[model samples]
Target chain A: MAVSSQVLSYYSFEQVDITRFRIRPEINRQKVEAEFSRAVYPYITWTDGTELYAGDYAVLIIRSDNPKLCRSGLKVTIGAGLLGAEFEKALSGKKVGDSFSVLWKGETVFVTVESVKNRHKPELSDDMIAALNIPDVKTVAAYQTHLEKKELDEFFFEHSRDAVGYVLKQVQANSSILVTEADWNQTVEWSVNRLAALAAMDGMELRTMTPEDFRGRIPVKSYDELVVLMQREAWESVRMSLLGEYLAKQNGDTINADGYETFLTEAAAPWGRTAEEYRKAYPEAYYLQNEYCDYFRRAVTAYVRKNYFKEEKNEH
Target chain B: MSIKFAEASTFDNLVREDDFVIVDFFSTSCGPCKILSTFLEDLEAELPFLSIVKVNTMEAPELAERFEIHAVPTLFFYQGGELKERHLGVLDEDELRERIERYLY
Candidate 1:
């Protein structure tokens, strides 16, 4: 059965004038120039005595003997400094055309230093711009404008969150859902039990954990207050999840194997898991419901922000 | 639930005349659409007052797009040319009957 049918009524009306949160972002020229430098000739020089060193760019072929290595065989040309502390410790003072072996993160790996060279950051100049081979850009002024415009776009997207946040806050506040008593109890119990589980993880019983034990860490004054906060949190969770679920379905989000796998991969990233592992560990309905919540939030924040939370904008 | 088959050219005309109409947006290749058709037949025999209008979504691409029909076997209920409710998926006989009965004015 659909969530709407179960809820019986989810009267969500009244639209927020998203334009009220209009934002104009200022571009930082220094940052834009740095980004441009990074974008162009990230690693292009080839005159550093062919020695492997920090800040030098090099082509390397990497292979691991460990069968369960994250990436068994990887080869690329990149900045040696970008490789991390483990690599710096092992690869310092090495020479080009040399093959060496090192133990990396518990995995025995082989590295071949194909070529080593120093890459210098180019100055902003018309000559550099001409060398860029960009179709319409052949001057330093044009290049600077291009980088500044790109930076401005990025800044705008970052700052536009206020508009999306306002829309979500307004809709969530205006909407009302019919949560059954059993559902409310289940939500509250589930949230409290998670807290209990956290207490267990820290070798303490939640029932016995005093206010002073929680003080300076959590804002709760007593166990009863904590439970009350948990209930409020649970209600908010349920409300947001239901709204997200309804919005996603109405916006053409469906259950497909490929889409679900993609969702699983992105959703599991913070939890330190692969898509398959997440699928196995997360309960179907729980993750599915959470997916909608995530999707709705993202949809509201995306470039298609004008689509969601529109009360009568669909009028044709 | 008397089945009133509607082509794209006649769909608007069909809905325009009925006081209450259930427009079934379906695809010929859809298995659920086939099953739902049989249930609609039984429903037609049961609820003589119900108006059932079937549109092959495959044959009526424009109509499907206009109604935002994403899935097969979607039903759009109309009362006096205004959309009242939309149900997606194949509903069983009893549930389908119940869904239609409530919309009756």
Candidate 2:
């Protein structure tokens, strides 16, 4: 349902799930171990034909008729969907040394199960933290805190996105807002770069890596499909930004100097820098263009949250 | 109810009195600690047999240091006077419930 381009409804912020706020720390040793194991290079161990369990950790070698699709030493956990369905289907119930060929993108890709390793959940001890090489994470407690903070920040950011979505939906309902070609291009480029960055994090180069090669890694079929999806996402992003700016102007409430100062101080304190030091280092214009605008967008969303939304407090 | 602790000996007594104990290292200034305090209270009501031990790091620096508590809202689960698990940061109600259930069952 498309909203009018000009008029934003008041109930936008109230409709979404604002209660999805709590972020639990990954304290379960089993879960933490599984995640850590997947991130690292899986160990290789030859095994006889045995029924592969759901949680089996293994390294697979994929060979394809398409030169760009051929890949080797790809570490994956069984049944995680990190590898596409074909790879899973090709390997499931088959034991070590199992090989199968599947047609992908008009070419046959041969998959071979090279090695399967019995993964043990490493104890979240000081030694494990040292091996991780994460700064200031010298102990299990520190590591848990680090993970918790990361998850918590992600939760808040997601909540903020929902809040912005609320505003955008109302804005769309009221009037016709136009998407410019420049904005569309910027959004598409941003999506491409973001996807590349994600691929890089997973130890793959996206520019050279073909869609067929990255089948199990990402949820894209062809380059054209990726462009279409990114275009849709970029449009939504641009619309949200436009609505946020419009709502901020409509509210006529300037930034709270004290709140802004506290925000800046808190941000800088983690890096051992004072608010003044941070301000001196980064130009006021730069902060206004990026940080200040983001803060204002949140403020606009929060205004809707406070005035229109009923924060259902969880009694339990 | 969470028993307040100011030193190591008090913590020792608190743990010794209860078979299943959870020590919550919290600070007055920490917002998450305040939220967790209410959750822990709800948990205590749910499992009346469970005992909670509260240690304010600001008031008892030695106890905090002894426990290696670098952050507030850190939870230390104990069974039979031995540390079973340590969880730092905020936990949802379901997560807290699940943790207790695992030990109880």
For all predicted structures, in order, the TM-scores are: 0.41, 0.34
| Stretches > 4 Å off in candidate 2 | A1-251, A264-316, B1-17, B26-36, B46-49, B55-73, B88-105
- The sequence of per-residue lDDT tens digits that candidate 1 reaches over residues A1-316 is 4333133444442345654554444778877755466444423344655775555555567766665443312322232222445666666677887787776666677888776655354455677787788778889888878888677666757667667667677777666666666666666776666566545545667777798878875589777888899788767667667777777667677733336766565544322234665554444554555565676667667633444233354432
Question: Over the stretch B1-105, how does candidate 1's per-residue lDDT look in tens digits?
Answer: 257888878888888675678888876656778888877765543343457899876566677767767567788888778888898888887776565545542
TM-score of the candidate numbered 2? 0.34
Clashes of each: 0, 12
lDDT of each: 0.63, 0.60
Candidates' DockQ values? Answer: 0.01, 0.01
* For candidate 1, the TM-score of chain A alone relative to the native chain A: 0.51
True contacts kept of each: 0.00, 0.00
Report the lDDT tens digits of candidate 2 across residue range B15-80: 767556788888776788888887776554323345788887766767776876766679988877
**Candidate that scores best on lDDT:** 1
